[model samples]
Target: MSYVSRNKFESARKHIQEESGNLDVLGPENRSWWRQKSKNKQFNQSNSSMTVETVKQLTKVFCDDEALINKKLPKELILRIFSYLDVVSLCRCAQVSKAWNVLALDGSNWQRIDLFDFQKDVEGPIIENISRRCGGFLRQLSLRGCQSIADGSMKTLAALCPNVEDLNLNGCKKITDSTCQALAKHCVKIQKLNLDSCAAITDLSLKALSDGCPQLTHINISWCGNVTENGVEALARGCPKLKSFISKGCRQITSKAVVCLARFCEGLEVVNLLGCNNLRDEAVQVLAEKCNKLHYLCLSGCSQLTDTSLISLAQQCPYLSTLEVAGCSQFTDAGFQALARSCRYLEKMDLDECVLITDATLIHLAMGCPRIEYLTLSHCELITDEGIRHLSMSPCAAENLTVLELDNCPLITDASLEHLTSCHNLQRVELYDCQLITRVGIRRLRSHLTNIKVHAYFAPVTPPPSAGGSRQRYCRCCIIL
Candidate 1:
């Protein structure tokens, strides 16, 4: 026996003797309870003395049994604890033990599985396993950025998970129309479907969605090259509850499709037709007259659209908050003035590359849309310091404005930076390639505007010519100038 164990046993015996005043009862039968319970099978008559080794073994056995009881958690307790963990945490918990693995992969905990965190690691086999575990019970599933998964995984989900409502398959490049067909055939309750950047999806998939998924309210088929006017028109005709439709790069869609959408989907609040060049003012006019609930609109790169569309939209869509006309070069200040006059709820406005807008547009916007929080005027060379002065003086600019982007505006000078010093809510300022703006002005602005980050792009300086006329140029410098 060790010295510590011997001393502990002797001290315990002495303390018991002093406190109880009953040394006669501390015999073999009373000292060793396990031996008494076992009918004296563990002891021998030749060695009845209480040895230190015997004390250590009995103490260890009792402690081990008590710890085992404390370590085991009740099934009800583990279930309640697992309810708070997300899908990723539950998946990680499955590695702890067989009991934990059974509870983590239970159907109740997997009703809404968001695979966004483990998208890179989740392939067909992993999805198949999830489908089998959560069959007929899963409601919402987000497989966003799961590029490694293909049609087989989706097919299994469609076959088993019938109650799926919100499914985000964003950037899943290998998915074809077959997966769409399966979803349309079974998942009738699907409300939100994101097929964004699903390159293989064609008009046939949209047709299937129209025929099967009529409950879809938010659908994003942006950059789906094969989706044309016919598919979008069919979808609008079928899905009357559609509120948000994003088809940014569908070049085949024309003004006719927009008119169909305005006529059918009257509850539409958000529409992004960026790069849909075939859409003209006539289509937008129809939308403004019909879609009264429109709140977000983006017509960037729609070169054919004129000021008439903005005027009509502002007059009709009273709840308009976010508007982007970035590549619409034809729109002048007259159209903007009309928009600013009516859309007082405008929160975010983007007028990138609109060269016609000058100080008058900014003044009108500042006076009319006081709630403007994000403003982008990149490459609008006509805007000068006078425009920024009007914006900084506006009531909302000091409290609401968070992001201000003035990239490549050559006419803007240090005076513009001085005006922005008063905008306390401004968080990000982008001043790329404005040659007139000096670093001293920007530093002064930063001192006044706390928690503000400035992003400026400076031109590269050419090194002095060598004696033989060999010109050397430094790498392009990007800093406040």
Candidate 2:
């Protein structure tokens, strides 16, 4: 018998013997009965041992069968598995015991290598080795947060991953239009691209991207300061199938370019223009009219947007699930009420820094958007304890709420949070910068909640200790408090 089967048999026999009682009978009839019982026990032991041995043999046979099946798996299955694994995990899999290593390093699995945060000095040699091994199979490459990657390394990647599609060079500060031009020439299959926070990228690079990749679906050029309205208009005209676009912090993009994009990209689902100070209500009105299928809209820091614009959005895009108007000082309670009434399916809503919103708006939101799972009212000066109490007391409070951010809403005190102990499903709660909440309230919450995570900023004043003689202060940003 195999080792596993032998071990199982021994264990089973030991357990059976332990459970059976040691008995002694004096009569002759009793002796015959004991002999019969001994025979039955021996028969059961033999049968069980054989069964275990058979099962062990079958398991080994099945594992071998699975290995054969893996060898014959289609290319699509390999790519799907590759997509599930990060770059580091993929590389490690390529070094896992011989057979698995070969399967992981196969050409089909090397098509998309997302080396996010690939450190320069340490990761360069590894990437070079990977490029040498599977250069021809590489297609989509993302090197986001690689501060050490320079023009030379990018050129090498472009040369190696020739059929590259969907390249994200976000935070690659050293990259310039020259690198873009090189990619345009060599990596013609590029589709989705993210140049966000690339300070050196200009309209020249965007132009190259437009000319090279005609099948682009998503693009994020946020914080790329040099991109103008002209480049944006050109992109709108070039990439018709674009579904998601984020140009937040690009000060040069104007209403004209935005209108053109809204008209051209009928399939657009998500559009973020946050921190685009130049974009006014007119631009938003145009977007609301044209992009009816918009589900996610971020107009945070668009200080110019007002209730009129939000009303237009509610009327036009009824499917909007996420709306962020942070730092838009002009938005009042009426605008939020309109949103709560219209967008009943809203999952996330951020009204941070909108000082005009009060408890009345929060009550309206609690009553209207019962499906809301995430709500943020950070720095909204007028929100008070009553508003938060209303939210915690709502019917949807106990089941769906996962994240709640009430940072900087000063009027919210311990009484408000005490009412939130019923929110059993709450996963994250941010109470940063709230001055009124004390350690006493936190202790009470901790006693009830075992799994909930609380992030609160402690107040400067020390409160009096309880009868127990000492008080425990929950520090600010203390998770799982």
Expressed as tens digits, the lDDT of each residue in 43-89 for candidate 2 is 34544334453454334322433433344556467557765676678
**Candidate 1's TM-score:** 0.83
Spell out the clash pairs found in candidate 2: 139-164, 456-476
- Tens-place lDDT per residue, model 1, 276-300, is 9999999999999999899999999
Over the full model, what C-alpha lDDT does candidate 2 score relative to the true structure?
0.77
Pick the TM-score winner: 1
Model 1 steric clash pairs: none
Q: Go through the candidates in order and give the clash count of each.
A: 0, 2
